[model samples]
Target: MRMKDPIPQFTDIITKASKLNLAYLHLLESRVMGAEDCEEGERLDFAYALWNGPLLVAGGYKPANAQRLVDTEYPEKDIVVMFGRHFISNPDLVYRIKEGIELGAYHRETFYTSSAVGYVDYPFSPKYLASEFV
Candidate 1:
């Protein structure tokens, strides 16, 4: 006999923890909301969830679009934005976001490589780091 997967149980645990106000929920996806040309209602629902509680939204968020969402749609909610593809090419993503530096584009060819060529090889921003030395 095959054993059942534990994902449901894991989700149950997360749900219980969330109900207790012990953990914040984070949602992530490979594509941005509007990039796929999804319906307005669909996007609105995603934004609406932020008003329910603390949430971290990750996936294809660029600095400008993420800021626009926060500034216009969910100004009253607690939400944290994150980037994945951008991070692959910008190890100093958080600093770049803070300093208004342009992010480097990721190399799609090396994205799924087994070696470190695309993973840890991305360089940190020199200008941003240089400012710290002064």
Candidate 2:
């Protein structure tokens, strides 16, 4: 399922959505593309989809430099970071990040393990109001 250049007709996408002011770049399970070690801005913009590198490492948040695309001409284009796993576990992650709370490590055992052990056991940070009293 690999593609040499998966970006299909970028012109068509741009033209169709020309009236739209904002667009999101969804990189779905794109680790297979080996984009984990690149600089924040060295990735490709596949139509409206931007395939960037890894999300987090060890215990640090390595935010990609999406602002690099925002020059004087395209200053209106804002990049929104969409973390798949983090958002799935912590639905209120956007608020947590704003509050400067610690995000716990994910349970690797349940990544694809046919059980709910890791899936449900991963602890949320204290900032998570729903699971705070748990």
Candidate 3:
């Protein structure tokens, strides 16, 4: 089936899954700025129509926005909403989210360094960890 528009194609897939009662999640990477033109209500409406299961939105959710996302009410109250990418540099991302702590900024320069400069060098927040009994 050849189609010029991809929206119909996507809708077809979702419709098929719904008929089969298959559970699936949609991971959206459209940055916040890209979605800025649309109102929050519009965004939620499109998201609900696309996928009713877990929605993992990445690329632009900071701690502040993530909080709002989780608090927002949608058609599917049980739908799982999650944030990503903001935790790339934050090893203690879960802890920080729970405690409402600020996340460390990721350095793009070291992201592709040959050595372990940015990949595994990000230190965990001391506040989230207990002192070692050395």
Top candidate on TM-score is 1
lDDT of 3 by residue, 29-105 (tens): 34434324222311434445666555555445666765565675453433444544446688888788777778887
Worst 10 residues of 2 by lDDT: 53-62
User: TM-score of each candidate?
Assistant: 0.67, 0.47, 0.64
Model 2 lDDT at residue 38: 23
38-113 in candidate 2: lDDT tens per residue? 2222234444333232222111122222223434323444544455555545545666666655544554435677
Off by over 4 Å in 3: 1-6, 32-44, 73-75, 112-114, 130-134
| Candidate 1 per-residue C-alpha lDDT over 1-134 given as tens digits, one digit per residue, 9 for 90 to 100 | 11264445545655565667645667653353433422121133333442367777775678987897778878987778877788888988888898899998787778677899988988888886697732
Relative to the unseen true structure, what is the C-alpha lDDT of residue 12 in candidate 3, on a scale of 0 to 100?
A: 74
lDDT score, residue 74, model 2? Answer: 33
CA shift of 78, model 1, Å: 0.7
Better of 1 and 3 by TM-score: 1
Q: Sort by lDDT, best first.
A: 1, 3, 2
Clashes (N, CA, C under 3 Å) per candidate: 0, 0, 0
Worst 10 residues of 1 by lDDT: 37-46
Query: Could you tell me the C-alpha RMSD of candidate 3 in Å?
Result: 5.5
Clash total of candidate 1? 0
Best candidate (score: lDDT) = 1
